[model samples]
Target: MNSPIIQLEHINKQFKNKLAVSNLSLEIQPGSIVAILGPNGAGKTTTMKMLLGMSKPTSGKISVLGQSPNHQQVRQQIGVMLQDVSVIDGLTVREVIRMVHSYYRNPLPIDEIELLTGLSEIDLKRRAEKLSGGQKRSLNFALAMAGNPKLLFLDEPTVGMDSETRIHFWKQVRQLTQTGKTVLFTTHYLQEADEAADRIILFSEGRIIADGTPESLKSGLTKRILSFSAQHGMIPGESASPSDTQPDHNNANSPHIHIKAQIAMLPNVDQVEYRNGRWSLYTTDTDTLIRDVIQRQLPVRDIRIETGQLDDAYAELLATMKEEQ
Candidate 1:
């Protein structure tokens, strides 16, 4: 693989007594779309600001495009769409685009920018102050792309967009990567990361807890749910009785509870709950449970297995980190 477009080494940022970023290091490959994820106070914004030269790290090395992040020449090759940027009120959309375009010696054409960002004829004529929230975000994205940047930084770029607009915006992002542009973005929307990012880096308490392709991250969180409706009388625990189940209840003579106890003892099974004649088994290995059920002939119906999703993995990882701390 080629050298990374961006690299950070042991980056740290401190404010007063608080440490915002803690020994963080990361690399962004060329033409990759990387999504940075974390809860509040996870040093996400601080990390991005350090890379954009908007903030200085208290300690450690930072490089963008093989140069120091604050290097003058680096400015021409990068674009940023910040969540808190306020547009200048007096200019029309077209005028604002033209003004930013002038800063780059060889920027994209005004017409191409308009098309790529979904700026319409009416939008072009409207003053910056008059555009709706979604329109303003679109304008922000348009301004970022005005430089034909080699690397783009988007901080919640779809914050105000409706579902349809957000979908369209993701398409434009893919187009940029197709042309060999690198993108690093921070978003509260985990689904967006799952759908758009080539790789995801999850941060917690100012540290990276997970880093990989979305599939890889989720696959590591291997929990799956198996639900099946029992046809015979309910198992001992499946009934609403408080009485402890007799040992005989799960013996070979009693098939329902026997199968239930057998399943609960499986190597990968986590827990088993029964309600309304339906048994819900939580396990890390769904195939083993399925095969056992078939082998035991437990008279089950409407069996369903649900694989772990990215959101589930993200939550589980964060919760685990909190507990560990």
Candidate 2:
């Protein structure tokens, strides 16, 4: 395995009375894309800033490309697209790319940068201020890649991009990784991480909640939801029906039954609605729950079982973390 291209050892950062990032340690390998995912104020931006040397760590150490982040040589091998736009508005698209290229020793060819970024459609002569949000984002990407840096940091790179442009941007990112450049980025969009990252680090409350390949993180959350519909009416909860309300027609009436069972203790199962002649249940252990439901609940009319989706796992993980905190 290759040595880590970036390393953060027990990194901590504080502001006044608040600890933005707390004892966060992470590693990024060469040619890999690692995405940091979190909600607002989770310290993702602060972590990235620390790695870039824009903000100093209150404690701990950070190294990028085997050297301290503050090292001039290490700085040359990195490119950044901050959440706050940093381009000069007066420069044209081509001019901005050229200016960034001028700062690097062996930048990518100007025509290649234009082609790779799909900037051919934009008027290269048009000033950055005149471009649409998506256009500007594409230009930002071009500038970041212009230097051909070995490591790149993109903070919320697709914030205002349209679906088509975002798709194109991801394609370009994949191509970059193929060329041996490492990418470390932070995104609020979990789907973006799912699509682009080879590995995902989930951050919550100034800590790493989870870290693994997208599939591994998903598989680690292996949960199944079992659902079914029944002809007979079923009570939603575990509580028994009131004895006083028992009607003589209870034995004869065939009302729809709905039961919601949560398997593996996942907190996704709300009250199951079984009106209109249908029954449904939600659970994390599909096969086991299905078996249990079949044996215990009995007489299910139709059954369906499926693994928990990425969104479901993510929600459950965060909810569990929040509850613990």
Predicted structure with the largest TM-score when compared to the true one:
1
Clashing residue pairs for model 1: none
TM-score of 2: 0.80
Q: State every prediction's TM-score relative to the real structure.
A: 0.83, 0.80
Q: Write the per-residue lDDT of candidate 2 for residues 197-262, one digit (tens) a residue.
A: 999998887889889988878776655555555432344432333342222324433122122222
List the global CA lDDT of all models: 0.85, 0.76
Native-to-model Cα distance after best TM-score fit, residue 66 in candidate 1, in Å:
0.8
Best by lDDT: 1
- TM for candidate 1 is 0.83
lDDT of 1: 0.85
